[model samples]
Target: MDERISCILSSLKKAKLTPKFRESEIIQLENIRSATMEDISSVHSTSYISSREQVMAEEAVLGHLEHDELIKDW
Candidate 1:
């Protein structure tokens, strides 16, 4: 999780406002494994999953993508 997001979640917990948040707002907190492999497979094609996993593995070793150039336009 990103530090900013972690801080936000911590603040929410401290405020005791989580239950007041709607289901959609809290969906991002659902555990990554909440979905079964079969369920994920249903949504993602086999090749797409393989390619994304490969990219993630490579990023883990090489570090995150440099977004400075991309963000300049935005």
Candidate 2:
């Protein structure tokens, strides 16, 4: 995370990009959660129905659906 942030700041620091708005003008944004299998299946023929609930891991926060399991089943 540190390396990624450093790279972004270093790259953009010399880019001469103007700020769209000041930090004081920044607005809070709401986060929308991921879609469930039932909701997704309505749009497609197949959907990944996760067998277990999600859990947080060190590397990443696991989603409600297991993407790897879904790919394997596919």
Candidate 3:
């Protein structure tokens, strides 16, 4: 996922669409606490989260999951 984003960003740089996006590279938000169910609940309902998880899990094959939706249909 990171690689794909980086590739797109680099391509944008090559295209000169983003003048200093490469020079001003993105920095990861370090030392952030992992979100728990309670945190997620603040924004999403339990049923929706569960349904979303089931969909993602169902799509996982051989323990691998790709963000292919960005390029192809699910």
Error of 1 at 69 (Å): 19
Quote the positional error of residue 52 for candidate 3 in Å: 1.3
Off by over 4 Å in 2: 1-29, 47-74
RMSD for each of the candidates: 11.7, 12.6, 8.1
lDDT string for model 3 (13-42, tens) is 678655344346545478899898889999
Whole-structure CA lDDT of model 1 = 0.60
Clashes of 1: 0
TM-score per candidate, chains pooled: 0.39, 0.24, 0.47
Off by over 4 Å in 3: 1-25, 66-74
Model 1: residue 14 alpha-carbon error in angstroms: 31
Clashes per model (N, Cα, C within 3 A): 0, 0, 0
Candidate 2: tens digits of C-alpha lDDT, residues 1-74: 23453466455545633133234654656897788767776866532222122122422452334444422321
lDDT of each: 0.60, 0.42, 0.63
| Top candidate (TM-score) | 3
